[model samples]
Target: MLEPIGQATAAAQNIWGDATQWGVGTGVGTVSGGFEFPSVEEIDAVLSSWRARQASIAQRGNTLELMVSSLTQQPAEDDATTGYIATWAQSLTQLRDQHRSMLEYIEDYIKKLEAAKQAKQAGEAENEAAVQKTAGDLAQ
Candidate 1:
């Protein structure tokens, strides 16, 4: 029950990391030296993959919620039942941690994407100005 939830959460985190890297770019070193921009197609592919992962995680979460509700209603009297409940709680905690981390990763990636877009726009504007200047000089 909870085990599946934990696994799904971990999968979500991995998917988030991969999608963010593909969308915004990733590197070590200085920002100016190591920066790399992925093509629009690559970013779109990654976004699609992330959406699929999100759907899977939501399904797992729904299943886990149902199991948890069922378990909660059950009368736990034996040692085995107690142990099972303990294990389920642990798995739930792990799942929550993974989900939180994935959300943070998504937020960070969004910020990175916005910065990249702004930089790209500025560069295009500069190039356009340069071309205009060159054309004017040629006309003279």
Candidate 2:
């Protein structure tokens, strides 16, 4: 639901990156400011919420399918109304699949971002430790 807002925020960050390349001679250049980076926990929570949404969608789809089946069995007289309901049989399923795919992609990306952030932090820590050891060795 609110995933599109998050995506738009990410898009803005990327757009800000482009400004750095064009502004050496120019007087006033765009500065990086006011960017809110979401924590891993926030991302995880969002992913979980989306998963729950997916489950609800699946369950609802199943229920709707059953209802539609019952309607078809009864054989309605109105072709126009029946035809519209029939279209939903395909549309609803497609909507579910598309939503699932999108959520999966977002969850995967968030997980990967978390992994990369952890790896970077670990590497920085190792470097600091190595520098401290070198300084201690020199002091002795």
Candidate 3:
């Protein structure tokens, strides 16, 4: 059981890389002076990466749920064993909820990124049109 948990933890680490690599909690949505917005391509790349990992996150959540279900089948003839099983199930449930929350976060972030990309592209198009119009005006 612990081994499965360790494997799940490793999977999570693989998805996010490391603690500092998590941009979900910080360094997002806030732009300081001189901070450049990500290029459309960069935003696409991030969306692609997170979309790829979304399935794995869902799988981890499923695994945690399975683990919780398995705890119910464990032999708990003694009071201590029953308490331990209850505790283990509670921990697994918490982990599953965390995974679900992370998945939701990723989904929301991806949508926001997509919206930003669209806005950037639209702005670029407008600028290009303005440049063309000014060029025509100058020729006339």
Which candidate leads the pack in lDDT?
A: 3
lDDT of 1 by residue, 1-140 (tens): 22334777779866664333443345323365544554444545555666666666666767666665665654667999888887887787677667656756765665565555556556667879999999999999
- Where is the poorest 10-residue window by lDDT in model 2? 26-35
Clash numbers, per candidate: 0, 0, 0
Residue pairs that clash (backbone atoms under 3 angstroms), model 2:
none
Cα lDDT tens digits, model 3, 3-104, are: 334777789777865654334322234465222344678878877998889987887777787787788686858999988888888888888888888999
For each candidate, the alpha-carbon lDDT, in order, equals 0.63, 0.59, 0.75
Q: Model 2: per-residue lDDT, tens digit, 1-140?
A: 22334777679757774433443431112255322223445546665676676676666657655655654553555988778767866676676677667657766765655554465456567879999999999999
Model 2, residue 102: C-alpha shift (Å):
0.5
Comparison by lDDT, 2 against 3, better one:
3
Which 10-residue span in candidate 1 carries the lowest summed lDDT?
Answer: 21-30
Error of 2 at 89 (Å): 2.5
TM-score of each: 0.58, 0.50, 0.70
Tell how far residue 136 is off in model 1, in angstroms: 1.7
- Candidate 2 global CA lDDT score: 0.59
Our tally of clashes for model 2 stands at 0
Q: Give RMSD to native, each candidate.
A: 10.0, 10.1, 9.5
Model 2 residue 1 CA deviation in Å = 36
